[model samples]
Target: MGPDQALYVVATPIGNLADMVPRAVEVLQCADLVAAEDTRHSQRLFSHFDIDTPLVAYHDHSDDQRTARIIERLEAGETVALISDAGTPLISDPGYRLVREARNRGIRVVPVPGACAFVAALSAAGLPSDRFTFEGFLPAKSGARARTLEQLAGEERTMVFYEAPHRVADTLDAMAEAFGEHREAVIARELTKAFETFHMAPLAELAAWVRADSNQQRGEIVLMVRGAERKAGATLDDESQRVMKLLMAELPPKRAAAVAAEITGVNKKVLYNWGLEQK
Candidate 1:
């Protein structure tokens, strides 16, 4: 059997129809079967591209038997393409079980990579991208979500999260609290679509803005938070703290942080954050 016998993990567009990659189209058209997160949702995509391949429902809920059937088809020399409702398969979506089992069975698993909302958002987010973490969607409950963010309190690498439209406001407030209200964060909403927007600000400010503007809460949201700054050098000495406090009483926080950094040899941003905490 040739490549057609293997399992194909295809990436569909996140929002823009034009984001669909050509190779993905060819694979979907040629595959013997397409297992989708939602067959009904995938049908619209297939219709747009005039692809009439057989469809089957596969999602996080798909049982072992469903996966076994797909694997058997692949083993029997029938190519099967796995796709999510949108974006790349298995990125906070389903198909992990099928993909892992396929590899275990020594079936060739090919990737048709394309649009990924978090990656696309991170690219234009203006956050430090050299190193980062993808923290998918946070827990919906306040207690679990708070605990989750608390674990990342010291995360120095940029952090990315996917948030539901309904829970956006609550998540932002929770993030601001756990990560420090002054921490920098970016909200990328409705990416790759006509009304797409990217809003960057401090966590507290971003949360406030999103709360005041109902429109920002209505679409797909990718939240990018600047990592906790590593405070280089030793902890602040008594003299430095004394001077910073005195300076803050007289000058603005920015100027106080600058002057304190000069005298204390600590990061100005660090001093600024300390001042914020002290307030």
Candidate 2:
């Protein structure tokens, strides 16, 4: 809006052009400059929208000199728009440094959000969304990826990640090996495009599906995994205490067992028996 006094982090469509928000287009068109992950990619987008703002490259591989140039622009009272090749910038993309620098200089940062693959997949994943974590892109090397997965083995919140087509199968295999074959997962591909597809199944089945069909291995992928189902820090004895407290509230033993099972996904029959033992 009103001549943005700082950096504008704009989100473009991941695949479909129509998903680009009008406010994003206006900011990109009117900004003093547009810093993109790839100048060539941004150029194409700009051409399509007939927005001729100057383009500069700012990516993971770029040098400090490039970031310095962008910071200088913002310091000089210029409103710069930062965008990624697709989707939102700085979500496993660059622009963090520029934003940080601008903030240190007291520049305002405006985020125009739209068309995030992770959010899209999560919303349709039918998984628990109340608590979740985004892991962005995983490490490319096998050992690093394995170690990463092992660290998240006990995590309880749903996790989201982005994986390239070439490595999707391998990543799934690694996940299965680290997390277990029966772990639930969903893979969303070519999102918001003509051939968009969502594939959901156990980890092993998904691995096999990707292996059996070459076509399934193409296009960007958003992978969602159900977090490990684990009890809280409380032990079996602590659970017994919690159940006792609830039962004391006059909730029937069967209803108490059902509620406890729903809370922990523990065996309802076992909990019911425990309730009897307590009584």
Candidate 3:
């Protein structure tokens, strides 16, 4: 029997076309239809590889009708390939709705991975990668953006974000404000492309560099910020302290410390001592 027809989510090169994997090429070549975030932008890659598969536009703004059409095609035993303008689809790009709809319709979804900008940047950003968060894009407005950063102020995991050239400086400034000027950060620009640059510095320095150098502000950018450092001898966070205080009101200090330790993963002794200080 022929291979089961499926929806292939292909990862295209972020910048350098050479990063496209052989399997991704094969999938796209064999796809009965290719759903691209931008038909014109993907056309260059298709032409470069000489793959003549029919292209359809499917992106963030695509309506339900468009997604329904793709699902209908997938249900009809035709293999469809989904691709973003660059990197994997649905990574701050479109295609989530289409993929979800296709799955609901019992269409098999296959991933043909290749290059991802954030992954590429994190791998080289010299930041702790054991645990991380991909916060795609921050709010464009200053107040909203600051509030968002404030919410993540205590995030201990490495943070990765995609930012537009125009807002890089402002985002960096807000990050410095929320995460602190001394927080280490890496700004990766035009990754995998000619003139690619990765600048590593403290948040304050990075913000200053971006503000001073207009060239650094222009490009496809990935901003990686080091996680919040746990202060020595002060392992319990503010939230844990608050929890401990609330527990102290209901229980004995020792019992409250023990409960807070269990709940917050903080050391019992630390919570006990902190509880004493609060009283």
Cα RMSD of all models vs. native, in order, equals 8.3, 9.2, 6.8
The prediction achieving the highest lDDT against the true structure is 1
TM-score of each: 0.83, 0.82, 0.83
Comparing 2 and 3 by TM-score, which wins? 3
TM-score of 1: 0.83
Candidate 3: Cα lDDT at 225:
96
Clashes of each: 0, 0, 0
What does candidate 3 score on TM? 0.83
Model 2 lDDT tens row, 1-279 = 445667999999999999989999899989999888999888778988999989888898888898888888888999899999999888888888888888887889999989788998899988889999999899999988986886676677999999989999999999998778999999999999988989899999999999999888999899999988764343355765586567646775556768888786777756655554455
lDDT of 3: 0.89
Clash-forming residue pairs, model 3: none
Give the C-alpha miss distance for residue 80 in model 3, angstroms: 0.4
